[model samples]
Target: MTVFILVAGAFTGPHVWRDTAARLAEEGAEVRFAALTGLGGRPGGPGETIDLETHVEDVVAVIDAVTADSGGEIVLVGHDYGIHPVLGAADRRARSIARIVHLDAGMPRDGVPALAAVPDPRLRVEVAERAAGELPPPARDAWPRWGSTAGLSEAALDGLTALAAPQPLGTLLQPLRLTGAVAAVPVTGVLCTGNGPGVEMLQMMVEVGDPALRALADARVAFFELPTGHWPMLSCPAALAETLIEAASGGGRRLTAADASRPPAHLRPFLLDVPERARERAGNTDLYLPDGPGPHPAVVFVHGGPVPAGARPTPRDWPTLTGYARHVAGQGAVGVTLDHRLHALTDYEFAAGDVADAVERVRADPRVDADRVALWFFSGGGPIAADWLTGPPAWLRCLAANYPVLAPLPAWGLADTRFHPVRAVSRAGRLPIVLVRAERESAEIAATVEEFLTEAARHRADVEVIDVPDGRHGFETLDPTDGAREAVHRAVGAVLARLKG
Candidate 1:
């Protein structure tokens, strides 16, 4: 019914789409694979002056030829670096394309080269260094290292590697030029969740109206996730093909501006008016306020890692932390998440002070029940909240921690605080605590958590321990399993129950 044009990423050719195209063809669709200039076994070698514009010409030529032959609408799909040329072509021929699919690829804006989208500074530098010449493909034997071999048979790997070729450096170095017309075509993103953090960060950028991802802001674009590696065609071809068919059929869910502005279905976003001084030091605080009225019990989320110096915190920056905040909000409490300075080894006390200030700001909010507040700490944030747990305020209802560091990390210069959580829990005085321990926790963190729990029990401190046998430290948001979800649900329920009483 529709013509499907597939474009492979750099260093690969049309052969990369062999399995997917075959499956789609069997499903009764017209499929054509577009081998970009200088890619695949094309006559020209990598040194051939093949730039982004040349690739765009290649895709546009295919669109013209396919449309002229069939007179049917076209679905243009681009993977990885292929996205740049496909997007450029779509912008040039917006009326001819029905839908555009970005498969685990970077979405570049006008005037930005594809290389600018690379997130790692070192990788960016490496690319720049190689910009003068052809960028060689990974060795055929190292397919596994490149993620192409995951879930694929040896024969499939051999076939893929044989088809690989050196990519022209010009394609990545050249900037993409667009007149904004491409937004007219419906866009669908089939994201690979194995790179969870990166995808989450992109979603956040879209949410906050970051101009870099403005193309996705168009109402025509939607996103779907596949729980596989970057090369989904090899890892989960069936699922990828099915998603593509759905997108082509206009049956996929759309991502709208309203969806981006609010928290997920379970929670709502709120802006807290922190002291101007606190805002100056730690940016702003985003609160995921639960549904319902009248002063609800609340929890202040202290996220791990002071972000790198000069790196500002965005809602999408720490997916795991933000996800837990939403979960806590879903369970009938206002979940407050803030951004504080990344602490140097000697700056733990200063960081703690900033967190305390955030807590005070949250308590002052009229929507929060100031009398029933709890502190939930994660990773490096654990030591920052130790003071509150040690001698909690009378209004503080409970404390919930997940794979937290109860003792100082001497390596980080986090030591000799007035009250260590392990030593202070004994005198915490009836303050209830819920600790969720990840089975795959680091040895040091596990040992510290063990000692803290032991001391709590010996002192008769009111505490509950929930073990997530299948979870890693950041399981709640990071590699979530059914067990992790259930563990988090129960943990939040416990904290809420205590606050309610």
Candidate 2:
């Protein structure tokens, strides 16, 4: 018997698949059901972004555990927005996923949110009103022709009602970023036709008409259709199970336009083919223009450790810390995160004018709004930030540090004399300097820095101290933990606010 991991669509928990699981079992296929976080029993954790990432992680964790016990690759079937998590999960664990089936689900496209794939105007409006609440309606009717159901039975409606749940706002709003890993996975689509009854009718008449279902067919994903309504698991469980088994079998049939129309929305590949003009420079700097439009404000994100090594952007780090850059642009500001040279970015070099040169370079970029240039740093980069403040470029508006290692510590073999926080503050010529520190950090370490700031203040320096709750060193480092990211967000926010002001 083949093992199948079934994922339910947004707003639904595993309970929606009870009948399907039973039917699959009867057909000799071992079936397991899944519910996404914020939808099923899984509750949202503190500071959770309430976005696609949370949902994707939920499916990935489940698949990893299931595949471990199955001792081999397993078939993963997704329904509705469940396809988002399934495709993303497949990217990370492709080896363990043998076949992926979209059960009346939308496939992943770069930049397109799952909700954009829905075809019905009324359904789209309902999903949007439930999500953004304030989004204005489109000028044209967005509904599709599919699921113009002949009808459904009262009993089927009753069953669907027993199964449906309120979907989360985040599920519909968050955008999915597809990588090459998802593109390579073999996929199959199952489309349901004809209306069943009650909740089943609503599900078919609304969800089956989604543009994503048809869009999947255009991408050459294998497709099959069932002449039943929305809740086929309830109305035609045996038939849906048979189709799944057939798709799982070696030869999958092709899908037709008669099946579903392709969605106008398409995923642009995620990899940013860095242009020749944005080439790696100075043997230490790495530049990036994150996906999406911009006359974005430019801020250089100086990595804390490793020269040039700090230049390479880690995928895990990009979504968290640098998310602020994207946020800034969305707020109508230009944001640029950069890699600074590790060895030469010392107090002397920073003071000598490297900071000013970098700021000028950022201003030179046409995409950057030169008036909004700032410097953001973390840990080891903190001192560089201090020096930049002390000797900033003509256009540098502000500087912010996250748990900066500015407190003089001889343990690392660097004298407090060369990297004096107080001295750096004194040199900034009174530019706005924002310092954020973790409340949980050692008092001795933070106290020394505070004393320096106090001294700087006595000398009339523009310094703002924000004590981040439960912060730690390198708080800007994005981890699965909470407070760190929020601290980074707060720090980035401060820098952006000062520049925009």
Instruction: TM-score each candidate.
Output: 0.59, 0.43
Model 2 regions more than 4 Å off:
45-49, 122-152, 195-220, 255-501
Best of the candidates, TM-score: 1
Clashes per model (N, Cα, C within 3 A): 1, 14
lDDT of 1 by residue, 115-179 (tens): 76554334457778873667777676644333323356666667777778877788889999999
Q: RMSD (Cα, Å) of candidate 2?
A: 22.7
The lDDT, on a scale of 0 to 1, for candidate 1 is: 0.72
For model 2, residues 1-501, the per-residue Cα lDDT tens digits are 588888876455787677778878888888776667766657767665466777788778878788677664578888767888788788888877778897766456767787765544345567676633222222211111222222235665554445455555666677877676766667887766432112222222222233433444444466666765445665677778888888887445543333235321111121122222222333223344544565566666654432323222332134323454555554555555554445322333443255456666777777777777777665555555655656766667887776665644322223334455656677777678777776754433455467667877777878777776665543333132455555555666778788777
Which regions of candidate 1 deviate over 4 angstroms?
A: 45-47, 140-150, 153-155, 197-218, 259-301, 304-338, 341-501
How accurate locally, in lDDT, is each candidate? 0.72, 0.58
